[model samples]
Target: MVRLMPRKGERGNALLVLYSALIYLFLYLPIAVIILFAFDAKPIPGLPLNGLTTSWFAEALRDEKLVGSLLTSLRLAVISAALSTALALPAAMVLAWLPIRFKSLVMSMVLGPVVLPQLVLGLGLVILLRAAPDMVGEPAIILAHTTITSSYATLILYSRFLGFRRSYIEAAMNLGASEFTVFREIVLPLIRPALISVFMLAFTDAFGEFVVAWFVAGFTETLPITIWTSLRQVISPKVYALSSVIIIVTLLLSLVSQLWVIRQTRLTSKAPSA
Candidate 1:
């Protein structure tokens, strides 16, 4: 009896190829559908490639309500992203700097919304706001978005902070730097990739959110809400077109941010050597 050591290299290559195909299919399948349906002249989605036309896109461009909703979505996303990042930066700092006893409890509390259904969170927020002075609008939407997205920001930033070389901050302090100054100068610059990643995640979550937005937003519609409303009335191909635009934009921004993070990490990894 003889035992042969497997050509571990071949197994690795096979696994890589399989994973690559799976990832590509997962990512591109929906995008392909969105693109195809976007150009489809027929309002109803089907096979046999209906005559290609730009009417859906043209209609999306001409739709003023859609435009308004998109603007609202953008504004909410930007505000939510900024507020979440601001809150997370400090919260993450605490989580990193202090050895908290209830770490799991704290992390779970922060990630409650992510684990819980958005519909449930929305319903709770709506009920809470009902007794107060009219609290449903852009403000309410932004507030709800911030609550959900801040947790993500905190997670991302905390990961970076936990992995960061604390000696840099310590060195800064040893060099007679103020605590705030050290954080601003050394800590911030080092963890910038995490900060940016969190900001983008917050923005994306806020922008794509439908449940929370629908529940909190009063009369002031966001893009997802608009799509929902339209979906009920008519399954407009323009909806697909609008979605395509959003998808493309999101993909572009995500790629850019990922590249930036990669570059920053590479720089950080090489800094000690330099």
Candidate 2:
């Protein structure tokens, strides 16, 4: 019995390690290939990864369509993030402090997109907006992005607001501070990081979102949609270059969020109690 128990324990540990490695490999193996192929000198993906080349990266940068697509994507992201933040701030503030009984219901409505499939949402929007052709441009893109990102913005900012010290406002009021003054001096600074985080999220998602933007802006192609077009019928190594750029930028953003920007959101060392 003792010998059997020892053998079982050893097998369990071995299985655990093997499973862990397999999971990681499954997750990263494709990404590793993408990175590897991005640098390959060959025009084709699989053949002769002999030497690395800077030419692909240069072509990616210089491609007029790619450049235009990048600019359009940036514009879409900026507009989306800005609109989302603008709409979410007041909504979140009310949600945090208002004495509404159906708070859960309201929250579900706000956070609906988190569960909803992006494709379904996109297709639905397309059907609904099919009657209105005039709304396809920056305005349509902005509205779609706002709808998609507002919930995220609200949730993030509201979570921060939950831990906020209301007494600071009370104390200021007791000392005859104006409502406007208290909000400006206290509330805004405290929620700044939350706003920034939401903005970043909104922009990132908007820039990469293929389906919704494609549907919402029928004639107007944001960068992702354009990139898809470039990829499909007219595939090229330039796509690899663009993919490489996207991967690098995304990785950098993730690093910044994890290491610098989010860490700057110091919750523990908050303002002193009232």
Candidate 3:
């Protein structure tokens, strides 16, 4: 028996795989540690696991403040994600398919939040909300999250819209379908998966967000804010348990969105030639 030497391309591929594995290890090792420590019997999170126990999760679940914050975070994420997706859809369609003036300028404005630092954006929002002091808590947080997440949603939707088949719209119109009818029956159905993907992405981002939410929350306490405040003093194992749960949820959402995007892309590629 003999082993064959790898070709240059094979060698390059192996190196790429190794590099990707290292990157993933670096990213997920800490998360793995946190999840492991969440179940540790020890009060403090560290190496050399002291017995395994699910008590931390139960403790976390029993905390009224943590439960309330989780609920608030979920509510905020849902509202912001829905609002961002709704606002982005029409804007993305127009920007991707229509011949509008100052298209670049409009796009720049839409994507401005992505480029702006979160701290700067939060400060700006805080200053702007000074006029409406009543809007400080949940309102301000929702608005800020929507603004930031909408940029991402718009970018995702814009790409999806750009790849859309105009022939479908034209054929529907030729059959005497109104523009709105065409959009409702054809465009929406075709891009539904992309919409879901964008919505999920927005929700996950808003759920995990901290800086902007911190600045605008005022008296509101979302999950991230609660976690931050907890970290200011002694860290609790319950917080670790909560964080592990959040990490799992976020990963699941992201995985679903990515799979949806991949499926949508495949379907798009399989569309019949015009």
Candidate 3 lDDT over 7-105, as tens digits, reads 899999999999999999999999999899999898987779879999999999999999999999999999999999999999898899889999989
Which predicted model would earn the best TM-score?
3
Candidate 1 vs candidate 2, TM-score winner:
1
Instruction: State which candidate has the highest lDDT.
Output: 3
What would the C-alpha RMSD of candidate 3 be, to one decimal place? Answer: 1.9
Clashes of 3: 0
Alpha-carbon runs more than 4 Å astray in model 2? 1-24, 267-270
- TM-score, each model? 0.89, 0.86, 0.93
* Better candidate by lDDT, 1 or 3: 3
User: Residue 191 in candidate 3 has what lDDT?
Assistant: 93
User: Candidate 2, residues 1-274: lDDT per residue as tens digits?
Assistant: 2554557778999999999999999998887777777777887766568888768888888888877878888988998899899999988888998888999999999988767998988888777777876887667787788899988898988887787778878888999989899889877876777777788889898888887787777677677887788667745667777777888888888787766555655653554666
TM-score of 3: 0.93
Q: Write the per-residue lDDT of candidate 1 for residues 1-274, one digit (tens) a residue.
A: 6758668898899999999999999989988898888888787866777699887888988999888889889988999999999999989889987999999999999889788899999999999888863777988898899999998888888887888788887788888999899878988888888888888889998999998888878898899988888778867888899889888888898999999999998998889731
The root-mean-square deviation over C-alpha atoms between each candidate and the true structure, in angstroms, is 3.4, 3.2, 1.9
Local distance difference test values of all predictions, in order: 0.88, 0.81, 0.91
- Candidate 3: where are CA atoms >4 Å away? 1-7, 264-274
